[model samples]
Target: MSQLKYKRILLKLSGEALAGEGGYGIDPERVHELAQKIKRVRHLDVQVAVVIGAGNIWRGQIGMRHGMDRATADYMGMLATVINALALQDALEQIGCDTRVQTAIEMKAVAEPYIRRRAIRHLEKGRIVILAAGTGNPYFTTDTAAALRAMEIDAEVLIKATKVDAVYDLDPKVNPNARRYEHLTYLDALNMRVGVMDSTALSLCMDNDLPIVVVDLWGESSIERVVLGDDIGTLISS
Candidate 1:
Protein backbone atom coordinates (compact mmCIF):
# COMPACT_ATOMS: atom_id res chain seq x y z
CA MET A 1 0.00 0.00 0.00
CA SER A 2 3.07 2.24 0.21
CA GLN A 3 4.82 3.92 -2.69
CA LEU A 4 7.09 1.47 -4.50
CA LYS A 5 10.77 2.26 -4.22
CA TYR A 6 11.93 0.46 -7.33
CA LYS A 7 10.42 1.15 -10.73
CA ARG A 8 12.52 -1.49 -12.47
CA ILE A 9 14.27 -4.44 -10.88
CA LEU A 10 16.34 -7.46 -11.79
CA LEU A 11 15.35 -10.55 -9.85
CA LYS A 12 17.99 -13.22 -9.46
CA LEU A 13 16.56 -16.66 -8.78
CA SER A 14 18.63 -19.77 -8.18
CA GLY A 15 17.75 -22.79 -10.30
CA GLU A 16 17.28 -24.75 -7.10
CA ALA A 17 14.32 -22.51 -6.29
CA LEU A 18 12.52 -23.80 -9.35
CA ALA A 19 13.29 -27.40 -8.31
CA GLY A 20 11.32 -26.86 -5.09
CA GLU A 21 11.26 -29.96 -2.85
CA GLY A 22 11.85 -32.45 -5.67
CA GLY A 23 15.58 -31.61 -5.62
CA TYR A 24 15.76 -31.82 -9.47
CA GLY A 25 14.11 -30.45 -12.61
CA ILE A 26 11.28 -27.93 -12.67
CA ASP A 27 8.40 -28.24 -10.26
CA PRO A 28 5.23 -26.96 -11.93
CA GLU A 29 3.47 -25.98 -8.72
CA ARG A 30 6.45 -24.10 -7.38
CA VAL A 31 7.08 -22.39 -10.68
CA HIS A 32 3.46 -21.33 -10.87
CA GLU A 33 3.61 -19.99 -7.34
CA LEU A 34 6.66 -17.92 -8.16
CA ALA A 35 5.02 -16.73 -11.33
CA GLN A 36 2.06 -15.53 -9.31
CA LYS A 37 4.32 -13.60 -7.00
CA ILE A 38 5.96 -11.96 -10.00
CA LYS A 39 2.52 -11.08 -11.28
CA ARG A 40 1.91 -9.16 -8.08
CA VAL A 41 4.93 -7.00 -8.82
CA ARG A 42 3.72 -6.55 -12.38
CA HIS A 43 0.45 -5.34 -10.96
CA LEU A 44 2.48 -2.74 -9.16
CA ASP A 45 3.60 -1.57 -12.61
CA VAL A 46 7.27 -2.31 -12.11
CA GLN A 47 9.45 -3.47 -14.98
CA VAL A 48 11.11 -6.76 -14.06
CA ALA A 49 13.98 -8.75 -15.47
CA VAL A 50 14.93 -12.16 -14.18
CA VAL A 51 18.23 -14.01 -14.25
CA ILE A 52 17.97 -17.69 -13.43
CA GLY A 53 20.83 -19.97 -12.31
CA ALA A 54 21.42 -23.48 -13.67
CA GLY A 55 22.93 -25.16 -10.61
CA ASN A 56 19.85 -27.30 -10.04
CA ILE A 57 20.69 -29.33 -13.13
CA TRP A 58 24.46 -28.98 -13.36
CA ARG A 59 27.43 -26.90 -12.27
CA GLY A 60 30.34 -26.58 -14.67
CA GLN A 61 33.01 -26.45 -11.98
CA ILE A 62 31.59 -29.52 -10.28
CA GLY A 63 31.50 -31.38 -13.58
CA MET A 64 35.13 -30.51 -14.22
CA ARG A 65 36.02 -32.19 -10.94
CA HIS A 66 34.51 -35.37 -12.38
CA GLY A 67 36.82 -35.22 -15.43
CA MET A 68 34.38 -33.46 -17.76
CA ASP A 69 35.89 -30.92 -20.11
CA ARG A 70 35.43 -27.48 -18.58
CA ALA A 71 34.02 -25.75 -21.64
CA THR A 72 31.67 -28.62 -22.48
CA ALA A 73 30.48 -28.75 -18.90
CA ASP A 74 29.89 -24.99 -18.84
CA TYR A 75 27.96 -25.16 -22.08
CA MET A 76 25.81 -27.86 -20.52
CA GLY A 77 25.17 -25.60 -17.57
CA MET A 78 24.19 -22.78 -19.90
CA LEU A 79 21.63 -25.04 -21.58
CA ALA A 80 20.25 -25.91 -18.17
CA THR A 81 19.58 -22.21 -17.52
CA VAL A 82 17.79 -22.00 -20.85
CA ILE A 83 15.55 -24.86 -19.75
CA ASN A 84 14.72 -23.06 -16.53
CA ALA A 85 14.10 -19.78 -18.33
CA LEU A 86 11.69 -21.41 -20.75
CA ALA A 87 9.83 -23.00 -17.89
CA LEU A 88 9.55 -19.69 -16.07
CA GLN A 89 8.47 -17.85 -19.20
CA ASP A 90 5.70 -20.37 -19.79
CA ALA A 91 4.59 -20.22 -16.19
CA LEU A 92 4.44 -16.43 -16.21
CA GLU A 93 2.59 -16.31 -19.51
CA GLN A 94 0.06 -18.87 -18.29
CA ILE A 95 -0.97 -16.28 -15.73
CA GLY A 96 -1.47 -13.61 -18.42
CA CYS A 97 1.79 -11.76 -17.83
CA ASP A 98 3.92 -11.03 -20.89
CA THR A 99 7.44 -12.44 -20.64
CA ARG A 100 10.51 -13.10 -22.74
CA VAL A 101 13.46 -15.45 -22.32
CA GLN A 102 16.78 -14.25 -23.71
CA THR A 103 19.83 -16.45 -23.69
CA ALA A 104 23.44 -15.34 -23.92
CA ILE A 105 24.00 -18.22 -26.28
CA GLU A 106 21.88 -18.38 -29.41
CA MET A 107 19.03 -20.87 -29.18
CA LYS A 108 16.53 -19.70 -31.78
CA ALA A 109 14.17 -22.59 -31.19
CA VAL A 110 13.69 -21.75 -27.52
CA ALA A 111 14.33 -18.00 -27.02
CA GLU A 112 16.04 -14.89 -28.27
CA PRO A 113 19.74 -14.28 -27.90
CA TYR A 114 20.88 -11.61 -25.47
CA ILE A 115 20.45 -8.16 -27.00
CA ARG A 116 20.81 -5.31 -24.54
CA ARG A 117 18.74 -2.75 -26.44
CA ARG A 118 16.02 -5.21 -27.21
CA ALA A 119 15.82 -6.41 -23.62
CA ILE A 120 15.45 -2.83 -22.39
CA ARG A 121 12.78 -2.22 -25.02
CA HIS A 122 10.89 -5.28 -23.79
CA LEU A 123 11.01 -3.98 -20.23
CA GLU A 124 9.81 -0.56 -21.34
CA LYS A 125 6.85 -2.29 -22.94
CA GLY A 126 5.93 -3.93 -19.62
CA ARG A 127 7.31 -7.36 -20.46
CA ILE A 128 9.31 -9.41 -18.02
CA VAL A 129 12.60 -10.47 -19.57
CA ILE A 130 14.29 -13.60 -18.25
CA LEU A 131 18.01 -13.85 -18.94
CA ALA A 132 19.43 -17.34 -19.27
CA ALA A 133 22.95 -18.74 -19.58
CA GLY A 134 25.88 -17.41 -17.58
CA THR A 135 27.21 -14.55 -19.73
CA GLY A 136 27.57 -17.10 -22.54
CA ASN A 137 30.98 -17.94 -21.11
CA PRO A 138 32.67 -20.48 -18.92
CA TYR A 139 33.80 -19.80 -15.32
CA PHE A 140 31.11 -17.18 -14.72
CA THR A 141 28.32 -17.85 -12.24
CA THR A 142 24.76 -16.71 -12.79
CA ASP A 143 25.27 -14.35 -9.87
CA THR A 144 27.77 -12.50 -12.02
CA ALA A 145 25.40 -12.63 -14.96
CA ALA A 146 22.66 -11.12 -12.85
CA ALA A 147 24.92 -8.31 -11.76
CA LEU A 148 25.98 -7.67 -15.32
CA ARG A 149 22.42 -7.66 -16.56
CA ALA A 150 21.32 -5.39 -13.76
CA MET A 151 23.97 -2.88 -14.76
CA GLU A 152 23.18 -3.17 -18.45
CA ILE A 153 19.47 -2.71 -17.90
CA ASP A 154 20.06 0.13 -15.49
CA ALA A 155 17.66 -1.42 -13.07
CA GLU A 156 16.75 0.56 -9.98
CA VAL A 157 17.46 -2.37 -7.70
CA LEU A 158 18.59 -5.98 -7.69
CA ILE A 159 16.35 -8.30 -5.75
CA LYS A 160 18.16 -11.47 -4.81
CA ALA A 161 15.64 -14.13 -3.87
CA THR A 162 17.24 -16.81 -1.79
CA LYS A 163 16.26 -19.43 0.78
CA VAL A 164 17.44 -17.25 3.64
CA ASP A 165 16.01 -13.88 4.60
CA ALA A 166 19.25 -11.92 4.60
CA VAL A 167 23.02 -11.86 4.81
CA TYR A 168 24.54 -13.05 8.07
CA ASP A 169 27.97 -12.84 9.66
CA LEU A 170 28.12 -16.64 9.37
CA ASP A 171 26.06 -19.40 7.82
CA PRO A 172 22.84 -19.14 9.78
CA LYS A 173 22.03 -22.77 9.16
CA VAL A 174 25.22 -24.01 10.75
CA ASN A 175 25.89 -21.22 13.20
CA PRO A 176 22.84 -20.40 15.27
CA ASN A 177 24.59 -17.41 16.75
CA ALA A 178 25.19 -15.76 13.39
CA ARG A 179 24.12 -12.11 13.20
CA ARG A 180 21.90 -10.69 10.46
CA TYR A 181 22.63 -7.30 8.91
CA GLU A 182 19.69 -4.99 8.25
CA HIS A 183 21.75 -2.90 5.88
CA LEU A 184 25.30 -3.13 4.55
CA THR A 185 27.63 -1.08 2.46
CA TYR A 186 29.52 -2.76 -0.37
CA LEU A 187 32.84 -2.21 1.37
CA ASP A 188 31.48 -3.69 4.58
CA ALA A 189 30.53 -6.89 2.80
CA LEU A 190 33.88 -7.08 1.02
CA ASN A 191 35.85 -6.43 4.20
CA MET A 192 33.87 -9.10 6.05
CA ARG A 193 33.68 -11.55 3.10
CA VAL A 194 30.02 -12.24 3.74
CA GLY A 195 28.82 -15.04 1.49
CA VAL A 196 25.61 -13.35 0.32
CA MET A 197 27.08 -13.04 -3.17
CA ASP A 198 30.27 -13.98 -5.00
CA SER A 199 33.23 -11.64 -5.32
CA THR A 200 32.76 -10.88 -9.01
CA ALA A 201 29.09 -10.08 -8.59
CA LEU A 202 29.82 -8.07 -5.48
CA SER A 203 32.51 -6.07 -7.26
CA LEU A 204 30.29 -5.30 -10.23
CA CYS A 205 27.51 -4.12 -7.93
CA MET A 206 29.92 -2.09 -5.91
CA ASP A 207 31.46 -0.42 -8.92
CA ASN A 208 28.05 0.45 -10.29
CA ASP A 209 26.63 1.57 -6.95
CA LEU A 210 23.71 -0.76 -7.45
CA PRO A 211 21.57 -1.49 -4.42
CA ILE A 212 20.57 -5.04 -3.54
CA VAL A 213 17.92 -6.52 -1.30
CA VAL A 214 18.29 -10.11 -0.14
CA VAL A 215 15.04 -11.78 0.89
CA ASP A 216 13.49 -15.21 1.26
CA LEU A 217 11.45 -15.99 -1.85
CA TRP A 218 9.30 -18.54 -0.07
CA GLY A 219 7.92 -16.05 2.38
CA GLU A 220 4.41 -14.74 1.75
CA SER A 221 4.26 -11.38 0.00
CA SER A 222 8.00 -10.96 0.46
CA ILE A 223 8.70 -9.68 -3.04
CA GLU A 224 5.87 -7.19 -2.86
CA ARG A 225 7.06 -6.15 0.58
CA VAL A 226 10.55 -5.43 -0.68
CA VAL A 227 9.29 -3.59 -3.75
CA LEU A 228 7.16 -1.41 -1.51
CA GLY A 229 10.28 -0.39 0.42
CA ASP A 230 9.31 -2.22 3.57
CA ASP A 231 12.10 -3.27 5.90
CA ILE A 232 11.76 -6.97 5.27
CA GLY A 233 15.34 -8.10 4.62
CA THR A 234 19.00 -7.13 4.37
CA LEU A 235 19.68 -4.23 2.03
CA ILE A 236 23.18 -3.89 0.61
CA SER A 237 24.11 -0.70 -1.16
CA SER A 238 26.59 2.13 -1.50
Candidate 2:
Protein backbone atom coordinates (compact mmCIF):
# COMPACT_ATOMS: atom_id res chain seq x y z
CA MET A 1 0.00 0.00 0.00
CA SER A 2 1.23 3.47 -0.78
CA GLN A 3 1.74 5.88 2.09
CA LEU A 4 -0.81 8.65 2.32
CA LYS A 5 0.56 12.12 1.52
CA TYR A 6 -2.04 14.06 3.46
CA LYS A 7 -3.40 12.62 6.68
CA ARG A 8 -6.36 14.97 6.57
CA ILE A 9 -7.64 16.62 3.41
CA LEU A 10 -10.37 19.02 2.48
CA LEU A 11 -11.73 18.27 -1.00
CA LYS A 12 -13.26 21.15 -2.93
CA LEU A 13 -15.79 19.74 -5.39
CA SER A 14 -17.82 21.91 -7.69
CA GLY A 15 -21.47 20.91 -7.86
CA GLU A 16 -21.05 20.54 -11.60
CA ALA A 17 -18.54 17.81 -10.84
CA LEU A 18 -21.54 15.86 -9.63
CA ALA A 19 -23.29 16.52 -12.94
CA GLY A 20 -22.74 13.79 -15.49
CA GLU A 21 -22.33 13.75 -19.28
CA GLY A 22 -25.10 16.25 -20.04
CA GLY A 23 -23.62 18.62 -17.43
CA TYR A 24 -26.61 20.53 -16.12
CA GLY A 25 -28.00 18.83 -13.02
CA ILE A 26 -27.33 16.15 -10.42
CA ASP A 27 -26.52 12.79 -11.93
CA PRO A 28 -27.11 9.85 -9.65
CA GLU A 29 -24.55 7.44 -11.08
CA ARG A 30 -21.93 10.14 -11.14
CA VAL A 31 -22.54 11.14 -7.53
CA HIS A 32 -22.45 7.52 -6.48
CA GLU A 33 -19.20 7.02 -8.32
CA LEU A 34 -17.80 10.06 -6.53
CA ALA A 35 -18.99 8.54 -3.26
CA GLN A 36 -17.15 5.32 -3.99
CA LYS A 37 -14.07 7.34 -4.79
CA ILE A 38 -14.22 9.00 -1.41
CA LYS A 39 -14.70 5.59 0.12
CA ARG A 40 -11.34 4.67 -1.38
CA VAL A 41 -9.75 7.74 0.22
CA ARG A 42 -11.22 6.84 3.61
CA HIS A 43 -9.85 3.34 3.19
CA LEU A 44 -6.45 5.00 2.88
CA ASP A 45 -6.93 6.24 6.44
CA VAL A 46 -7.21 9.84 5.30
CA GLN A 47 -9.75 12.07 6.97
CA VAL A 48 -11.84 13.95 4.40
CA ALA A 49 -14.09 16.99 4.49
CA VAL A 50 -15.81 18.24 1.36
CA VAL A 51 -16.99 21.71 0.37
CA ILE A 52 -19.32 21.48 -2.62
CA GLY A 53 -20.27 24.45 -4.79
CA ALA A 54 -23.73 25.24 -6.17
CA GLY A 55 -23.05 25.89 -9.84
CA ASN A 56 -24.93 22.82 -11.02
CA ILE A 57 -28.23 23.99 -9.65
CA TRP A 58 -27.83 27.73 -9.46
CA ARG A 59 -25.00 30.16 -10.10
CA GLY A 60 -25.69 33.45 -8.36
CA GLN A 61 -23.63 35.51 -10.73
CA ILE A 62 -25.52 34.24 -13.76
CA GLY A 63 -28.79 34.83 -11.98
CA MET A 64 -27.77 38.35 -11.06
CA ARG A 65 -26.78 38.99 -14.66
CA HIS A 66 -30.27 37.91 -15.63
CA GLY A 67 -31.71 40.71 -13.44
CA MET A 68 -32.22 38.94 -10.14
CA ASP A 69 -31.38 40.60 -6.84
CA ARG A 70 -27.79 39.82 -5.90
CA ALA A 71 -28.59 38.80 -2.32
CA THR A 72 -31.59 36.69 -3.35
CA ALA A 73 -29.57 34.96 -6.03
CA ASP A 74 -26.78 34.26 -3.60
CA TYR A 75 -29.15 32.88 -1.01
CA MET A 76 -30.71 30.62 -3.59
CA GLY A 77 -27.25 29.44 -4.52
CA MET A 78 -26.57 28.57 -0.89
CA LEU A 79 -29.70 26.47 -0.73
CA ALA A 80 -28.59 24.71 -3.90
CA THR A 81 -25.33 23.77 -2.16
CA VAL A 82 -27.32 22.32 0.73
CA ILE A 83 -29.24 20.23 -1.78
CA ASN A 84 -26.01 18.94 -3.28
CA ALA A 85 -24.65 18.23 0.19
CA LEU A 86 -27.66 16.16 1.16
CA ALA A 87 -27.48 14.19 -2.06
CA LEU A 88 -23.80 13.48 -1.45
CA GLN A 89 -24.49 12.49 2.14
CA ASP A 90 -27.12 10.03 1.01
CA ALA A 91 -24.77 8.54 -1.53
CA LEU A 92 -21.92 8.24 0.99
CA GLU A 93 -24.13 6.70 3.64
CA GLN A 94 -25.63 4.20 1.20
CA ILE A 95 -22.12 3.04 0.43
CA GLY A 96 -21.57 2.34 4.14
CA CYS A 97 -19.39 5.36 4.82
CA ASP A 98 -20.29 7.25 7.97
CA THR A 99 -21.10 10.78 6.89
CA ARG A 100 -22.54 14.01 8.23
CA VAL A 101 -24.06 16.91 6.31
CA GLN A 102 -23.58 20.20 8.07
CA THR A 103 -24.93 23.45 6.70
CA ALA A 104 -24.01 27.03 7.57
CA ILE A 105 -27.69 27.88 7.63
CA GLU A 106 -29.71 26.28 10.41
CA MET A 107 -31.79 23.50 8.91
CA LYS A 108 -32.08 21.09 11.79
CA ALA A 109 -34.69 18.96 10.08
CA VAL A 110 -32.36 18.28 7.16
CA ALA A 111 -28.87 18.61 8.50
CA GLU A 112 -26.88 19.63 11.51
CA PRO A 113 -26.01 23.30 11.77
CA TYR A 114 -22.37 23.93 11.10
CA ILE A 115 -20.41 24.03 14.34
CA ARG A 116 -16.64 24.20 14.15
CA ARG A 117 -16.01 21.90 17.09
CA ARG A 118 -18.54 19.34 16.00
CA ALA A 119 -17.19 19.29 12.47
CA ILE A 120 -13.67 18.72 13.77
CA ARG A 121 -14.90 15.99 16.09
CA HIS A 122 -16.52 14.21 13.15
CA LEU A 123 -13.19 14.15 11.34
CA GLU A 124 -11.42 12.98 14.51
CA LYS A 125 -13.91 10.15 14.79
CA GLY A 126 -13.24 9.00 11.23
CA ARG A 127 -16.37 10.38 9.60
CA ILE A 128 -16.68 12.47 6.44
CA VAL A 129 -18.06 15.98 6.87
CA ILE A 130 -19.89 17.55 3.92
CA LEU A 131 -19.94 21.31 4.50
CA ALA A 132 -22.68 23.18 2.69
CA ALA A 133 -24.32 26.62 2.43
CA GLY A 134 -21.34 28.70 1.38
CA THR A 135 -20.25 30.22 4.71
CA GLY A 136 -23.87 31.22 5.43
CA ASN A 137 -23.50 34.63 3.84
CA PRO A 138 -24.02 36.31 0.50
CA TYR A 139 -21.29 37.60 -1.81
CA PHE A 140 -18.89 34.80 -0.88
CA THR A 141 -17.95 32.12 -3.34
CA THR A 142 -17.86 28.50 -2.31
CA ASP A 143 -14.17 28.66 -3.18
CA THR A 144 -13.78 31.04 -0.25
CA ALA A 145 -15.87 28.75 1.91
CA ALA A 146 -13.70 25.77 1.01
CA ALA A 147 -10.55 27.70 1.86
CA LEU A 148 -11.98 28.89 5.16
CA ARG A 149 -13.14 25.42 6.20
CA ALA A 150 -9.83 23.85 5.26
CA MET A 151 -8.10 26.37 7.49
CA GLU A 152 -10.60 25.85 10.28
CA ILE A 153 -10.17 22.09 10.20
CA ASP A 154 -6.41 22.35 9.91
CA ALA A 155 -6.52 20.29 6.73
CA GLU A 156 -3.12 19.21 5.53
CA VAL A 157 -4.00 20.11 1.95
CA LEU A 158 -6.92 21.34 -0.07
CA ILE A 159 -7.66 19.05 -3.00
CA LYS A 160 -9.53 20.76 -5.82
CA ALA A 161 -11.36 18.21 -7.93
CA THR A 162 -12.18 19.71 -11.26
CA LYS A 163 -12.95 18.65 -14.84
CA VAL A 164 -9.56 19.55 -16.24
CA ASP A 165 -6.48 17.39 -15.97
CA ALA A 166 -4.26 20.26 -14.84
CA VAL A 167 -4.00 24.00 -14.60
CA TYR A 168 -3.22 25.62 -17.93
CA ASP A 169 -2.20 29.00 -19.24
CA LEU A 170 -5.58 29.38 -20.94
CA ASP A 171 -8.91 27.60 -20.94
CA PRO A 172 -7.71 24.35 -22.44
CA LYS A 173 -11.07 23.77 -24.03
CA VAL A 174 -10.75 26.98 -25.99
CA ASN A 175 -7.03 26.69 -26.67
CA PRO A 176 -5.95 23.15 -27.39
CA ASN A 177 -2.28 24.08 -27.25
CA ALA A 178 -2.41 25.81 -23.85
CA ARG A 179 0.64 25.30 -21.72
CA ARG A 180 -0.01 23.24 -18.65
CA TYR A 181 1.42 24.11 -15.26
CA GLU A 182 2.55 21.05 -13.34
CA HIS A 183 3.56 23.19 -10.40
CA LEU A 184 2.67 26.71 -9.35
CA THR A 185 3.07 29.07 -6.45
CA TYR A 186 0.02 30.83 -5.04
CA LEU A 187 1.51 34.12 -6.18
CA ASP A 188 1.95 32.71 -9.66
CA ALA A 189 -1.66 31.71 -9.72
CA LEU A 190 -2.71 35.13 -8.44
CA ASN A 191 -0.27 37.51 -10.15
CA MET A 192 -0.52 35.65 -13.44
CA ARG A 193 -4.30 35.95 -13.22
CA VAL A 194 -4.47 32.19 -13.35
CA GLY A 195 -7.87 30.86 -12.33
CA VAL A 196 -6.82 28.09 -9.97
CA MET A 197 -9.34 29.57 -7.61
CA ASP A 198 -11.00 32.92 -7.11
CA SER A 199 -8.75 35.69 -5.80
CA THR A 200 -10.17 35.70 -2.26
CA ALA A 201 -9.72 31.95 -1.84
CA LEU A 202 -6.28 32.04 -3.38
CA SER A 203 -5.29 34.81 -0.99
CA LEU A 204 -6.52 32.83 2.00
CA CYS A 205 -4.57 29.75 1.01
CA MET A 206 -1.48 31.81 0.27
CA ASP A 207 -1.75 33.62 3.59
CA ASN A 208 -1.86 30.30 5.43
CA ASP A 209 0.74 28.61 3.21
CA LEU A 210 -1.62 25.76 2.54
CA PRO A 211 -0.73 23.50 -0.35
CA ILE A 212 -3.31 22.70 -3.02
CA VAL A 213 -3.58 19.82 -5.46
CA VAL A 214 -5.86 20.17 -8.45
CA VAL A 215 -6.96 16.87 -10.00
CA ASP A 216 -9.45 15.59 -12.50
CA LEU A 217 -12.39 14.12 -10.65
CA TRP A 218 -13.32 11.95 -13.60
CA GLY A 219 -10.12 9.92 -13.39
CA GLU A 220 -10.72 6.36 -12.22
CA SER A 221 -8.20 6.53 -9.39
CA SER A 222 -7.25 10.18 -9.22
CA ILE A 223 -8.44 10.71 -5.67
CA GLU A 224 -6.57 7.69 -4.32
CA ARG A 225 -3.56 8.51 -6.47
CA VAL A 226 -3.41 12.02 -5.02
CA VAL A 227 -3.81 10.86 -1.41
CA LEU A 228 -1.07 8.31 -2.05
CA GLY A 229 1.23 11.09 -3.28
CA ASP A 230 1.22 10.25 -6.96
CA ASP A 231 2.22 13.19 -9.17
CA ILE A 232 -1.06 13.16 -11.04
CA GLY A 233 -2.05 16.84 -11.29
CA THR A 234 -0.97 20.44 -10.83
CA LEU A 235 0.37 21.17 -7.36
CA ILE A 236 0.12 24.75 -6.11
CA SER A 237 2.00 25.60 -2.95
CA SER A 238 3.72 28.27 -0.86
Best by TM-score: 2
When superposed on Cα atoms, how far off is each prediction in RMSD? Answer: 1.2, 1.1
- Worst lDDT 10-window in candidate 1: 17-26
**Residue pairs in candidate 1 whose N, alpha carbon or C atoms collide under 3 angstroms:** none
User: Residue by residue across 1-238, what tens digits does model 2's lDDT show?
Assistant: 7777899999999989788676679999989989999999998899999999988898888888889998899899999999999999999999999999999999999999999999999999999999999899998999999999999999999999999988999999999899999999998999877675898998999999988899898887998888888998899998
Task: List where candidate 1 sits over 4 angstroms from the true fold.
Answer: none
Q: Model 1 TM-score?
A: 0.96
Regions of model 2 farther than 4 Å from truth: none
The CA lDDT at 5 in model 1 is: 91
Best-fitting candidate, scored by lDDT: 2
Reference-based lDDT, each prediction: 0.91, 0.91
